[model samples]
Target: MKKKKYNTLWLSFLGVTAIPVLAIFIITMVVARNEFYEMRAIYGPNFIPATRESILMILIFVAGLILVANSLWMIWMKGMVIKPLRDIEAAAKRIAKGDLEFTIVTQRTDEIGELCRDFEEMRRQLKASQDARIYTEQQQKMFISNICHDLKTPITSIQGYVEGIMDGVATTPEMHSKYLKTIHNKANEMNLLINELTMYNKLDMDHVPYDFKEVNLKKYIDDCAEDLEDELATRGVNFGYRYNCADDVTVKVDPVQFSKVIHNLIGNSVKYMDKEDKRIDLRVKDYGNSVMLEIEDNGMGISEKDLPRICDRFYRGDSSRGKTKGSGIGLSIVKKIVGDHGGQISATSKVGLGTTMHVILKKSAGGKNG
Candidate 1:
């Protein structure tokens, strides 16, 4: 109890007030008889020293006790309560004044110390929140600026072509049709940017609405490949799909979001296709407790520096093969969706050769869910 932080104040009170009082009392009793005669001489021969001496002793003892108590109270109040409160007050003022450049220090192990520590923790958290808010605001501004920069080019091109048609600059029927097609393409590009922005904002979270359901992996991917083959063929790109997994291989995934992930991956491959003999191959395999999906493309591969950051939101590379690499959020969406579904996505690429994207999803319990 004596070693406790709160109990020490009680001990200090006893030492300064009650213990000193007991000592003062004992000394007065010891000297009472001797002081009686001295009191008689001082008061006068007829004076009643017996009663009056007792009064004087009581008065002196009471006065000394009051004086000691007042001194102790002043000392304790200044050191224990007042000084700490003042320091905390100063800290509050500094924090209120928008300054977070200092630290709080205290050596006492009492309630004051705990209060100081808590206050410091609050300040530290507040500083961190403030810093994070500032960074987020900066990133938001950059995002808006990037969107504006990208939108300006297409918007200007569309305007110029429309003006050309109106100004009769596209006089021939062929020129008019070409101008109309270019304008339509530019408008589509703008719409794609808007869609990417909307999707990115939705996926930039930990708890996206993932409706997980068990599905045979091969059959699901086969359907996806079937849908994409016709589209790729229209663009003169060959598409292939392979499965080395068991017929009963199954995994839990959100059907809608997973389809987007597949399309986005292939979309990137098609976007970077630089060779006339464009080709894309997708394969799936069972790997113990996880299933691996790979998409390889004969496209202009990402450079060493850009490969690492390719999936980062709004990151654009130096490759000029694709007219514009898009709004730069497709692969980020892929990663986000994959991670939300308790999976992983990665890529490997070499410039001028090709690239392979790997996605691994945890196999469902009872892998052969037949």
Candidate 2:
């Protein structure tokens, strides 16, 4: 559409400029013809005008033609070239001044129009990059604030416990032992926070090493669930597993990192248990070329708004913040580990019911469970 408009402008310019030149040419031709006829009648058939007069007339005619043409050419250039160039120059100046909102509007079909289009595209890209940078900086600030706040709680607890022991407040052996254990637990919590931060940085940098192997999916999940049995029991959470696959369904994955994924998810579920009947179900189901592993819990579920961002780094849901002790990067680490294994993870939850985490992994090429 813009090209067509500019093409029409060019045609209009040519037509307007040609009309005056055509008129001048026609008037000159008519006057010259009339002068010749008059000369023939007054000075007989073979007569010609005096050389001086002829030269003067010819010079005047040529001068008038040149003057009219030059004026028309200047007008055409001003409208077609100078004005559009000035507009582009001004738009560039505005962009350099950080005014990205300015748009270069043009109806040119030539090189100038293309230049404007390219400039607009560049401006849009610059604005987008600026916005992304701003968002990242804000997120970084928030992450630091959250981490400091998280660390402070544990550090404060450890300090108080140590101070109590030093002041002889824990006089009894049992009291001393309890205070020491409490201090140890607070230190452990701080260590966990630091570990999460380190792991997140590794994941971001793609530096987390993996040792991939083919393992039976059913056995892997069963083992992982069994390992968590004692922990679940300690929290009064009933844990169960069901394998809906044939004997030898297998997938290639990094065992240690994959274990982390399982532990993080199960731990998250345990941390958020709000019901008396706390239960977690780990299930492995076989599809034709892939397996679906699920860890579902009857704990407090995520809100719809927070569910989408659960796997985002440093994103702690409002409900999860006061309810659990975490740096909010566990799910992000889990997500990254799963993604690195060429699998995908997702969560579905209702606020009051529970949250179900689903991991889908492609079956090993040699593993057939038929």
Candidate 3:
């Protein structure tokens, strides 16, 4: 039952209005009492006049009524302002008590309304941050689960083979050679996985520098084509390379990493050639300030869905060729190298058609000079 605080100006108005009525009532009573006394004196009648006590009594009655009426009016005016503030206070308390479900009912166009909007926005941001944290934690758990499964199989195979050799179970020379080969192969797989993990960690660091230089686009293309031509011919695949760029169409990039990129794309194409007429096409074009290179193949192309994630580290799609090569980090490394050179790379594929990778690199101001 807290008392309501009335506006000071409204209370003052009530006081001012009461003053005039009180003064008039007092003055009228005094004047009427005097006139009655004067009439009695002048007429010489025995009738008694109203005295001072009667005037006082009339004045008191009139002043009390005026005060009461003014008080009720002031109470009504104060209620208009108090109710909205009380509702806002209650809502705030509920929010403090962990009930953010309450909706504010403020139509005020003042500081209070602005404060309410800010509070709502802050709550929304906090909720989003909480959701993101939960999602990240779930992803971390899944990554660990997948890593365990991936590591356990290879280590178990290596252990089994090594133990058989140690127990003298491999009697013949061929059997011993076979066991040793199994052990060696498993060890190599483990080493490769560890290397991939290590390299990713290093790349995540802030200061790992890459070697960048101006590379002759045509010469590099020719070198890769020459090296892979014999291998492709042996596998009955026709590999065509065209370097339409100028002989000096140079771009600033890491040569070693770029070589790895070419090696991986060509190697993967040859590995997954399922058709009788397998073909791979490589081409480079000079577009003044930039150079674009494309590698396209008619092998077992990836699905439309997997094209988005093919460049992600360790993301092996269902369309993967037989388990014949590296730890599926080739495309990811290619993407990272391209990105380091301030370039862009993308892939397009159809289920039955083929896959094409396009890379664009900006030529640096440091032109190629021998």
Between 1 and 2, whose TM-score is larger?
2
Predictions in order: lDDT: 0.84, 0.84, 0.73
Candidate maximizing TM-score? 2
Candidate 2 structure quality by residue, lDDT tens digits, 1-370? 4553355445665676666656766786777778888999998999875654665576567767766776687688777877887787887888889888867776768997888788888988998998888777886788888888889998998899899999999999999999999999989888888988898999889998888999987778778878888778888889898888877878999998999998999988988889999999988887678888889998889999998998987788889776666777899899999999999999999887999999998999998954
Clashes of each: 0, 0, 0
Note the residue pairs that clash in candidate 2: none
What range of 10 consecutive residues in model 2 has the weakest lDDT sum? 1-10
The clash number for model 1 is 0
lDDT of 1 at 199: 84
Residue pairs with backbone overlap in model 3: none
Q: What is the lDDT of residue 39 in candidate 3?
A: 88
Write model 1 residue lDDT over 1-370, tens digit each, in one string.
Answer: 5763465555666666666567666776667656767777788777664564665678577868776776788688878887888888999999999898888887778899999999989999989999977766765676677788779988999999999999999999999999999999999988988988888887775536778899888889889989999999999998888988888888899999999999999998998889999999999977778988999999999999888978877666867423564666788899999988899999999889899999999888878632
When 2 and 3 are scored with lDDT, the better candidate is 2
TM-score of 1: 0.64
lDDT of 3 at 80: 52
* Candidate 1 Cα lDDT to native: 0.84
